[model samples]
Target: MNQAIANLASEADRAEALQLQLEAGETIVELDPKVIHGSFVKDRLDGFTDPKFIELREGLKTSEQIIPVLVRPHPDIKGEYQLAFGHRRVEALRQLGRKVKAIVRNLSDEDLILAQGKENTDRADLSFIEKALFALRLDQQGVRRQVIMDALTITSKGVLSGMISLASSLPTELIEAIGSAPSIGRPRWETFAQLLADPSHESTWRELIRQEQFHALSSDARFERTLKSVAVRKEKVSDEQIIKTGEGRKIATAQSSKRAVKLTIPTKHTGEFAQFLLRKLPDIYEEFAASAANTTSDNE
Candidate 1:
């Protein structure tokens, strides 16, 4: 994108540009959102949590759906359509209970892929993982690499093949389990994919991902949690050391391992200090107990 052109373009112009990359070059039209089904195969991110998506929804609430989405008449479903691009618009209108404005062309399966990929590419909208997943979907349909490259504007077939392979390595259940981790990029996903290749990590991966706390996390955090769990490189040895002072000191030692922890006050430094500790244990124990309960609750 030229800086000057981008700088001068209004929001409406951007929306039109974002949406109007129809592969069939069809005329735009107004249609009801309820009548349009999503792609036959899922090619886009699932959950609509992106801030831009939310903004689009809020914008639709206040204004008419000006930017027309690209849609094709559904082959199987009479009087229905399939979206090539503009899923965000479709989703927003669906949530708002509003009719969609679309360009209804009878696009071929391959054309639909092209149109969808092109529109997202023009907008730079798809995350690296999202693009990888979309590539995997296109490949599953037996779409040619040249077509995929042209659609996604990738010059390298090797990169495209790698993306599909990486995406295919992980189960669909696991992808949905993780949601769309938009904040995670290629390197992290590649690392996570490599970790998934090990059979021994499966149980640990399932355990980490299945936790309620995992679901409670942001998309990025969810990805991070999975990556950290089974990778031995991330395996940490927790510290255990005692601080000492000649007579008495405020210093204490907290010893921790992977599974257990202990806090100690050195008896060598202050003889008979155990009695003082005992006397203060009630207050200290209360605080510790409260903290432990909070940690447990957070984990749960």
Candidate 2:
């Protein structure tokens, strides 16, 4: 038995070394969890059933598939691996009282950030509201707003901005429901934010949310109906700026036509980077002026 344990440890070590290499840059097959963290046990032993556990339990039992997880070593986290993704898999392992399985990859600091961003962007299971909330957090992290738009494959900045605004405006409970709702999307959330801001129509909006019938309404129709409800009661205006229509509102704002330019230099020019930053500012203004002139000519 002791010899078996020793051999297992050796195999794990070898696997971990290979996985680390993959995380560094090399692309390889998915790795097992024992190789990454030395054990599959979850530190959190909560019995809650969530999407993560469901996927893991089903995948391990019914499907023959290798689940991918991002394992980053935590400075303060001890005993278990920090999950960059696969929150569900980690939890499911805990619930089943079994060893967790994962792909062990060593990621650099920058790579981890990019991984986190892309993981959130690529999730097909995320609801409209969840996507909005995720995007909002990414925006707050000082991740370039356009990065969120591009990486998420959002067609327009307006859709991205609307989601951010919707997440910010809704109540926490409602936000969670929104995240779970099947029919909600960027346009719906943006429209709902406008509706919820109106004091006179708060009850109706609350009812719409409470009953879950909002899912049945088309996004444009819902926004229009909500706005119409508020329009009739304009005399009962509260301190909040009530939107009677989506027009001229901040929700569906247009994207700026500016493209970003990145510059790299040799390590020796470290001191001259400040001058490089200064040199790029005028180019932005020049681009904006040129764009405006083109627009004016097209209109004329």
Candidate 3:
């Protein structure tokens, strides 16, 4: 009878604490990890083999999840919940087949996204490209630009524009293939985007990413390899050739590469040569065009 009275007292104390929590706009609850679905917009590219995730899983094996995940009652499914944040914790708990401690709230779609993005920003764990892609996904989903900027903590319109542009320029498949390259920054990603501007180069990346060897590499290494694979190798410039008059007096020196020829004329002759080259360019281009047409005809 004394044990039963103690149990009743404990239950009453718990109820009072829960009421306080509700009044403070939060109610902590234990939920089956299986019933909590991930946020609609993904903000991470962490796989099972990811070192951080592995570490989290291993840590959870021994310690309790002190931080509670934020969740909302499932809008569509009765008796289930949708996660707002703490995806890693929920996933770890799910893998361990343990209950998830969560803070339940009533949140609208925008509210959920705001909470999700805020948590990630506070943690400062999402990579540059991951944040960009998340913004892009929110944009694609018709979320207001202001909301996206607020969610990402972006203050400048130009910054937001660049993020969306970078995300839009790359093929989604390629981004997924590369995963989140944490060490790679904006400049390298922009360079990679420029390299892939030629559609033919994308196929090279596609084929390379399909290979088992590429998949074996780490995310950052995969990005490096992919960038190297599609990068245009600059052709070696040929040795300089001397140009001379009929008397063999050197007038200029010319160096040629696959794309261009640079002629270095003495400064004294600059004006005269510039005028002369301008005068002769039309005839030279006509001859070149005729020769190109003949080569094409012969090949056909």
Please name the candidate that would achieve the greatest lDDT relative to the true structure: 3
Q: How many residue pairs clash in each candidate?
A: 0, 2, 0
Give the worst 10-residue stretch by lDDT in candidate 2: 38-47
Q: Per-model C-alpha lDDT, please?
A: 0.78, 0.54, 0.85
lDDT of 3 by residue, 127-208 (tens): 8899999999999999998988888899998998999999999998889888989999888999888877766476688899
Task: Please provide, for model 1 over 185-277, each residue's C-alpha lDDT reduced to its tens digit, 9 standing for 90 to 100.
Answer: 888888888877866478887887779998888777777877878675325424446666686555567756677666766577654786687
TM-score list, all predictions: 0.70, 0.48, 0.71
Clashing pairs in 3: none
CA displacement after TM-score superposition, residue 28 of candidate 3 (Å): 1.3
Candidate 3 has an lDDT of 0.85
- Write the number of the candidate with greater lDDT, choosing between 1 and 3: 3
Best by TM-score: 3
